[model samples]
Target: MIAWRAGAAYPPAGPFVPVAGGRLATLQAGPERNARGTVVLIHGASANAADPMEGVGRLLAARGFRVIAFDRPGHGWSDRLGAATPAAQADRIAEALGSLDPGPVIVLGHSWGGAAALALALDHPERVSGLVLVAPVALPFPQRVALPWYWRLAAQPPVAWLLSRTLGPPLALYYLRGASAQAFRPQPPSEGYLERARVPLAVRPGALLSNVEDLIGLPAALERQSPRYGSLSVPVLIVSGDADPLVRIEAQAEPLAKRIPGARLLRLPGLGHMVPWVAGDRLAEAVADFLPEAASTR
Candidate 1:
């Protein structure tokens, strides 16, 4: 195991470590000594790492795993904004893992972050001991063409630009609310949660452009790499909500599970895409079950 002393300047609660290629802004809480293993939590598009995984991190830490949550590039404090392709993001995570002492480390990702984690596992399998995918958007599902003709027309170039520039923030907020509503039935998000999320939505200047680029580039990336899932040697646990509107279970989770050898799948009957937020403790418990004996025992 590799041990690097924490710098005095680093936060006792959340430490910021500089990786060789890029910095990984991480928040960790757990036993100072005899930590079982590290669990790196990755978040989704338009949202930073802290927003989605913080609660889950706290829960996991309580269960004895050293949980580290970091902001993905272009989304949070590590704002080296440009094209944040899945492959590039994965490479950065690989570098961050290098800084830590070798142990059984689990990579847990939500939504787009799940795709990023998958990329990491594909590119650097040795760095990950296991994977927990929460409502992962794994494959490119069929696009909905039933919307109004004008909506489709607006999705094209300059018109889309005009609409995006004019109402992007509001539209983003609307979509966020819509996602929350569709994913979490019976109990909608509180005003405070949405309001707090608005801060990140409002402050992120490059979010719209980055999201568009991510959508444009992701399909090709998945097409290129989908066939290689069978080659992954690491243990994988896939969790998804049947009610998730954004990611189709058939197109994403089921197919990917079939391709990957020994991959376990857990489908929540009425749960939505926000599984990590809505069912975090339950998800963590499920993940804890899959962890290797060396890591889980500690």
Candidate 2:
């Protein structure tokens, strides 16, 4: 009941599709057939498919591109499959893509989802014709950052299960508004973002456990994955805000672009971490410009 209340606080925006590992929930817009191309959206930690669906997915759909956003494994209405690593998440998402779409699709990932996007490109290159990574956490922290005490405690399996049923949802709800507000630092969050994004789904016991595990396990995954960026052959477009305090541009996007041969980097002067939400118009324009090239390659 607690898991139901916390994760299902808001109903899923779309349907579920069976895939390897488990099922995935997805929100799609645009024509199912005869569209210019398909765009697959992978959201980050503490977010569901609605985060990008409400931001850029619908906009791209209206522009005649098929836009589909997935609730990453263990997030929103999707099942948790012990998918803490990007490669594992990438495999699950790739399986769904293979079953659903007939051709390669443009994959766009935001924040933590960026790592999964890169993983997909590296492991399942045939599934991705191009990549759009926004404020992505592509590299390990330059310094050994200490984990929060609560996070460390919660990392214990039994403790996480206990907290999830008891205090996790309530505590997560208490800070939801503030965290949402902080994501758009320097720029206010879009109107009705909290309602539209369905962020409360992150509070569920299973989702919380998956999210914590993802965070704790990400550095090691990046260490193993970052070395392969130079080998990527797909068209890569990385968009980041110069003022993003959460994922510094210097550490992630800038260097990532340097590593990938022929990758394009767009640095928005005054933007923050929530680029897709606040800069949808600009983002759409960039995607529109790049689509022809991305499509041509497929």
- RMSD of each candidate relative to the true structure: 7.2, 1.5
In candidate 2, how many Å is residue 203 off?
Answer: 1.2
Query: Which residue pairs come into collision in candidate 2?
Result: none
lDDT of 2 by residue, 206-269 (tens): 7888888888888889999999999999999999999998888998999999999999999999
Tell me, by TM-score, which candidate is best.
2
TM-score of every model versus the real structure: 0.79, 0.96
lDDT per residue as tens, model 1, 1-298: 0001111221223566676545766666666567667788888766665555454777788888788776776555554435367777788777777876545478898888888888888898777888888877666543343234555555566766665566665566557667656545534654455443332342233445555556555666776767787888888899988877767677688887888888889998877677776777888898778777325323
lDDT of 2: 0.88
Taking all chains together, the TM-score of candidate 1 against the true structure is 0.79
Give the number of the best model, judged by lDDT. Answer: 2
Q: Candidate 1, 296: how far from true, in Å?
A: 9.7
Alpha carbon lDDT of each predicted model: 0.67, 0.88
